[model samples]
Target: MDFDVDDAATLMALLDEKRPRRVTQSLLSGWDMLQTDLPSRERIESATAVLVGTGLATVDEDWGMLLTAEGARIRRAVPGRGLGMRQIPGILGAQLRARGVARADLTLPAALYDAAYSAYMEAAAHREERAYRRHWWETWKPRRQR
Candidate 1:
């Protein structure tokens, strides 16, 4: 019944699976700019492991990360339900019953989940802090202000 926000956030990210759009990335330079910033490699790996363990996602060495069918359905339904992240267990437990799955088969450890969220945020902040655009106009824009 009790759940941490950090844990829920991490679980949400696990549920929100993604894969590279190689064609789009190849065709458009701006694709990188529009993409969600990647979490640290360590964070991503750890999360991927957890996702795979939980049967929420699968990673293909060639294709990157993807949601399992169940994961995708849960992602679409649960995230937009307007429930607080802390209600993750409640919803997930409901899902188990609906799917005729054994609750004992799933592990929802708070410490493990919390670590993923914290690691991702830390990495993103470290990566973005003091960063600036590389375009020619970007170089001049700061000088123009001074």
Candidate 2:
């Protein structure tokens, strides 16, 4: 499957949120960081299929699309694993201080950190881009001008 960064991010976020087990609907609902636009049911299903096919995620008769062992490993390797939302900014600040570079300046070796970082950044950027677009449309742009 030719899944893009955003798709991988969505899968990973879903796996993180609904760890251990999750059905399709639950995965969709729990994807707060990545599903603001809310893809059609067809798209969600297709993405799930791709994730499973790639072995980044797994599905059972009961659990729709839970993380595989590989997936868990990837999650744990993320720069700020086990941190809650409230702690992310602080953790990122600490990382930046320790590294002597901006968080955005850091890049992981492709062999080691590529998959997890790719997925995380994809989801994060997707949300940021969506929010920017929404603000531009709803607040920045004048409706009368349009």
Candidate 3:
């Protein structure tokens, strides 16, 4: 969802309510708060573009793209915040299963620890690769000038 600063701010405000909100209502409320003309369908579409670009929201096949985990975390960390705790264990369990974290293996405490450690190491390696790429770009550009 692409949104500008105004729209982003509005979404953040509504998220503070910690209640499930419809996309349409949220858009309307945002416009109301801004004291601007009501948003047309086209305007809403444009705002969605901004929101998605900024990584503030995402869409899922099951649940139309709402705020992402990072967006939720930001909402929670805000002062005087009241973010909802959506259980979503099904989502986490599904991700684990997709990553081959067997449910039966979890029953064995020792195996569960080992599986988790392996997954953590895999993620750390990917992160390190990204960091290396970023560092290389930052360093190589300057050296090439000489």
Per-residue lDDT of model 3, residues 91-115, tens digit only = 3223323333111100113343344
Best-fitting candidate, measured by lDDT? 2
Candidate 1 lDDT over residue span 4-117, tens digit each:
222222433334455532111221222122223433333334444544666666655442456677777776776636775445545654564455321112333445435545
User: Candidate 1: global Cα-lDDT?
Assistant: 0.44
Question: How are the candidates ranked when ordered by TM-score, highest leading?
Answer: 2, 3, 1
Model 3 TM-score, all chains together:
0.38
For model 1 the local lDDT of residue 139 reads 72
Q: Evaluate model 3: give its lDDT.
A: 0.44
Q: Deviation in angstroms for 30 in model 2?
A: 2.7
lDDT of each: 0.44, 0.49, 0.44
Per TM-score, the best of the predicted structures is 2
Q: Which whole-number lDDT from 0 to 100 does residue 104 have in model 1?
A: 15
